[model samples]
Target: NSGYQQQPRQQAPQQFNNQNRIQSMNQFDLIPMSYAELFPALIEKYLVQTRASPPVLAKLPW
Candidate 1:
């Protein structure tokens, strides 16, 4: 009835060190300003050099 015995204990699985895992973020440059800031400057520069055409009216939705 007691023929089987507990097996000898073994060390737990080895964990990977930080050095082993590849770096997630390797950014080499900083983020520039968003389109909102850049677009206005571009539009202003274009308007100064180019003339605007007549505007077309459109129906408004309620």
Candidate 2:
């Protein structure tokens, strides 16, 4: 019974993190490539707004 109780406690944080990861992925998916071409400067603006680091920029295909 105690093991069952602890199981949920451990799973709760993992579930919460998965939810956050999914939400961020969804947000990124919503941004179309056309938008990047339409407003070139907005890409830099977005990176700044999102507080992305130089290492992150290097990883991006753009």
Candidate 3:
């Protein structure tokens, strides 16, 4: 039996370039930060402000 030939992949015209991607990112004024650096600060800023009334006793595995 003969196998079907694979088709060539096409790159979309709206593909992102570095400057465009960076420009899009800049719209958020976001700079990449290490998870180690951002996580603690984020947790501190958000978790400290959070009040969990009748806090969760346990989470389901699912």
Ranking by TM-score: 3, 1, 2
lDDT per residue (tens digit) for residues 3-41 in model 2: 211111122222346346422221122333344353566
Between candidates 1 and 2, the lDDT winner: 1
Candidate 2 least-lDDT 10 residues:
1-10
Cα lDDT tens digits, model 1, 9-35, are: 445555568678332433344225544
Candidate 1 residues lying further than 4 Å off, grouped into runs, are 1-31, 47-62
Error of 2 at 16 (Å): 9.7
Clashing pairs in 2: none
Q: What's the distance in Å from true for residue 48, model 2?
A: 5.3
Error of 2 at 26 (Å): 6.7
Clashes of each: 0, 0, 0
Say what the RMSD of model 3 is: 17.0
- Write the number of the candidate with greater TM-score, choosing between 2 and 3: 3
List CA RMSD, all candidates: 26.0, 18.3, 17.0
